[model samples]
Target chain A: MSEDLRERFPEAEWIDSHDQDVVRIAPDQLLEFGNVVHEAGFEVLADVTAVDWYRTRTPRFDVVVNLLSMQHRRRLRILVGVPDGDPVVPSLVPIWPGANFGEREVYDMFGITFDGHPDLTRILMPDDWEGYPLRKDFEVGAVPVQFKASHQVN
Target chain B: MTDKTIDDPEIEEVDLWVSGTEEAEWDVYSTDEGAQKMRLEETGARLTEQLGSVVTDDYDLDDIITEDERMIINMGPQHPSTHGVLRLQLELEGEMIRRSKCVIGYLHTGMEKTAETLTFLQGPTNVTRMDYLAPLHNELCFSLAVERLLDIEVPPRAEVIRILMTELNRIASHLVAMATNGMDIGALSIMTYGFREREQILAFFEKTTGLRLNHNYIRPGGVAADLPPGWRADVSDICDTITGRLTDYEDMLKENPIWVGRTRGVGVITAEECRAYGITGPTLRSAGVPWDLRKAFPYSGIENYEFEVPVGEHGDVYDRYRVRIEEIIQSVGIVRQAADAMPKGDFRIDDRKVTPPPRHRIDESMEALIHHFKIFTEGFRVPAGETYVAIESPRGELGCYLVADGTGKPWRMHTRAPSFYNLQALPIMMADSVVADTIATIASLDPVMGDVDR
Candidate 1:
């Protein structure tokens, strides 16, 4: 089914979802997620999600998409590669504006940014918050204070 | 507040020191209003050399706010529309904000630190707690990251089930955003409707995963179980019901003059600044950037499916609402497809390295029982390497970076949360906008504190 849709929509490429058995796509192809096949009639944005590769050669996170078209009655997928130094993939706000908040969340919890997104700020934590909690190695609290308790607390 | 004796907890106030030549004196109080209190003069240029950014890159304090007449107002760590414990120190000239400094960490839970000490596969079970509303999405992102390092392939059925569960959770997560955004604008009924729909989704989750919120169902190499009996029918029913309620939510908020007036022209940030600041998701969409991770990188079984990426005219609250509302319809369609085309196979990989033997095997086979015991106690070893994986979570990009030194326990782990990065651009978005619009702007972003401060 996915192959037929790809053949139907010449602008798309097929991505292997490892052995998970679903076809995936790349981030640059994000705009064509559902609309390219709109002529064939798929109008749903089933999911916009990501995955983190803790042991990648570059140690970066990969963003993935799972799209559904109710009109054409089909499905599609996409993938984005983000660097560890700056895990920033372009925000899909302009394509599927619904992604605005979800992408912001990916930034907040994981610290990977959605580039070109407007209003990038702390939605959950304070604006000056530090650390991305979702990263596999993110420290939960301030590093343990080294010295003994300075004094007694009330 | 730190542990101290008898003395009043001295708040580390901002931009208030006049610099007494001989005395290291600071007012230790918030500024009057809207005054951008830079760290240079107050901390003094001498301190930068003493102890500041070791990697300084021309952060000109002079280029910081020059206007002296601005008044300062602190919004949060306790103020509304901050989403969760965010504290914004805003410099305002009456209603116009001149400069803004954000103060965070009041809600930090140290979730990442905990991950480092735990076994690798157990990591996903913990991360789901951070972004509580979108638990499955969080689990999927973290699980895939570990799988990448191990270079393992999950079973086909497991992958499809994960896609179905996480997508349903995505709709539920978006509903929370919608509900809270409405509550911020005093549209109480919308919150009820939003949560009302979310409740059904949660109920479905309980049926499959046995938990409502932070379910540890999506594990490395596969899921915890096959879909429960009648899961398809339950999920289908949910999709159908939500389809009807979504219209009610639209009627309540979409294009309503008050909502439009408050959200449409409020908190405008153009695409250029957005890119420069490293932003993404709906906020980026509002600015006219059409990038999305789903179309960019298809993982699990997403590539086999089809869907839409809804764009907006203006990067504003109104446009965001339209996008999300349309997305709910999209989510319904995705669920429908998964139910209609879900493949059949073992839910988890055959490798005992990831999962323990089935309970039945434990009774007759000594190896199976021993393997189960070992997995529960020692966890499986992973290749000595580091890897990072990112997923397009409800709040943008959720990523995990892990380091393994040929041990079950991860040597180091890091999460690249989209919330922290996106939150940096709030000043640019809310600076010139009125205080009233700030609420709308934040609501549109729909940030969650657990994920933000995890």
Candidate 2:
């Protein structure tokens, strides 16, 4: 599967980070690459998450997807670079129906849009929530918690 | 609701008395309460304006219903059988469901957002609250992710202890599932019997970790402490007690005609549907997919343990029940073997950077004191990298993905909560089933809202 991913997209960088097969693909090729991986027997789309590399890297966000091959007992990590402005990636919902809530979550937390997601509404946050709470610059909004001493009886 | 609570004289709010001063009076509400209310209102207004365009144009109940005569109803944010705070919008044709949508985030606590702020040493403290029913699994997953990032090896005894503790927690969690499933299905006696056996396991937990639930015993490099004296006997007794009670559960529910009738053919989702929905644990196992993480992706040396991955032939509510029952027995066997072959060694790694010095050493040596103080204050740093660690949590394959940026705090932490994914199967399962069967479908999934909303 790793070799096929490399052959299909010559631009894809195969990385070996943290004992898992990590592949960095372009944002544009994400949907196509996912199709190839699915065809290569990676049946389980384990998780989909993003990391905010705002100041450290050019393409500010890294959208990470973990895939598991139950047949071969193997796993792979696919990372796609998404920039800050117009941060959009093709949706994997068409390929894997399981990415529905996960893509919605990435959209909710990081403000990264998945273009073809069926229902691209917020999953974890309220519909009216303003900022992406998981972004690096986004403040962890706090409410004042007043501590009042309890009274005692004799 | 407000009128009844305020009008009832028996429901008066408790009065407060200050302890320090002679006046001994305390006002529960702050004097600036009005200002606080105003700020909250402003925040609400701003949110409404930002999302106004999208919220109004979102999915309509009219779109899901096939005909104008079809009825649309809200199942619950507070429904008893929907499990914790899960609201379902059901479009029904008579009593049969046509299409359903699950509305979640009622219990959202932003645990992943919170993990970035806490140091690696404190990360487990936050994640453990995610799965309140199976907290040890949450802690173990988070700890394993951190340990993988740090590239540290745990002591042999600590690894064995972790397996032992997590297996016991799996049994306790499944018992809660059994209890709630029975209560949801109207078998009231099973609730009492299940909790009665679960309490014995919690007693063992308290004796070992000094807490009934959410024991933060497992740490990044190793466990927090060694097993207390006579823990072997305590665990042995717990296994024996629960193993005997397992048969009682079978007798009550296994062949009972009503139980069989309600669950046998209800809430059926084929193995293909389960895979597409990314469901795992017993729900996936009940569909005849033997894709358990313990065997597929062995972490923390689970390969050494000998156990069976119970699978069900028919992927119905009854099959899910049978799978959980068999799992409890297997957990008892694993615990017995672990107790008999408990290794003799340190409970934590010897690395001073991760694990603290001994209490006696801290008193005798000045350097040891400073090292202990520093380790507590500024935690050990991890190299810049990212990793994903998964374990066979009670619900499913609970996974933790961690990204470190060469600092004590994590760059980003995301938990692949099994319940969050498993709950997605609700709409699939609810389609074409009767309204009464919704309760059975939900109880079979056994999703904890903490795990879902985290």
Weakest ten-residue segment in model 2 chain B by summed lDDT: B33-42
- For model 2, report DockQ: 0.32
> For every model in order, what is the iRMS?
11.8, 8.6
As for candidate 1, its interface RMSD to one decimal place is 11.8
Model 2, A103-135: lDDT tens digits are 888998999999877566677777667788899
Q: What is the lDDT of residue B334 in candidate 2?
A: 86
Candidate 1 chain B — worst ten consecutive residues by lDDT sum? B46-55
| Per-residue lDDT of A118 in model 1 | 48
Candidate 1, residues B399-419, lDDT tens digits: the string is: 665657788977666566667
Which parts of model 1 are misplaced by more than 4 Å? A1-154, B1-69
Tell me the DockQ of each model, to 2 decimals. 0.07, 0.32
Cα distance off (Å), candidate 1, residue B16: 19
